[model samples]
Target: MVIVSVVGGISLLLLVFLWSIKRGQKTVRAFVFLSAVADGNSVESANELAKRIDLFAASELQKKAMIMVEMVFGGSQLKLISHARREGFDQ
Candidate 1:
């Protein structure tokens, strides 16, 4: 009985850990999407991007979320900008 309970507890913890990882991956993907929005010329101003970020981010995490989005964008700025330019030219 005790062994069974221990196994069950460990299984529950593993499941919770897996769920948390999945949630984190989703958040990262959202940050990447926001990064693309930030880099795109379609947004007229930083304020507009901020508003969109505010909508996507939780109130408490707005600043951190913005930083992450910026990091994703800034880190890939060359590639992203080139891709954007290429798309624009193609269009």
Candidate 2:
């Protein structure tokens, strides 16, 4: 009975560990999708994204995605300002 209980406890811990890893992967995938959208390019398929995600650390992937988003936002803001200037809105 003691052996069975030990095995069951270990199994539970292993399952929890696997769950956390899967959750982290989903978070990374979401970040990658956001970056892809911000860049206005074709979004990667799930398998492609999963493969790419596996290549980098989760934190690294998140950081790169955020930088991509920031750049896209910055560029769009500049373009808006340029358009406003062309329309003489500043005056």
Candidate 3:
């Protein structure tokens, strides 16, 4: 009986640890997605990955952060494009 209880406890602990890792990865994915959005890159993969991972961020905060990141990304993209165009490397 004691041996069985020990095994069950270890199993439960392992499950909890796995869950935490999944949750943490979700948060990291969201942050990465936000960055991609900010730059306005076609981040289909990152977006899908972030969506696949489950996170606990409030919808409002997530949306705002995404928008903010998107704006930053868009700004940088424009600057680079302008610079490239001026340098005669338009593509």
Best-performing candidate as measured by TM-score: 2
Cα lDDT of all candidates, in order? 0.48, 0.52, 0.51
Question: What are the per-model numbers of colliding residue pairs?
Answer: 0, 0, 5
lDDT score for candidate 2 against the true structure: 0.52
Q: Which should have the higher TM-score, number 2 or number 3?
A: 2
Could you tell me which residue pairs clash in candidate 1? none
> How well is each residue in 1-91 modelled by candidate 1, as lDDT tens digits?
9999999999999999978654443344344444545576443342243334332353455455446546656644344434433433211
For 21-85, candidate 3 gives per-residue lDDT tens digits of 55444434555555555566555654654555444543324555445436654633334334323
1 or 3, which is superior by TM-score? 3
Off by over 4 Å in 3: 43-91
Q: What is the alpha-carbon lDDT of model 1 when measured against the actual structure?
A: 0.48
Highest-scoring model, lDDT: 2
Model 2 Cα shift for residue 46 (angstroms): 8.8
Per-prediction TM-score to the true structure, in the order listed: 0.46, 0.54, 0.47
Over 4 Å off in model 1, which ranges?
41-91
lDDT of 2 by residue, 1-91 (tens): 9999999999999999988666555545555544444455444443354346663566567555445435654524334334323433221
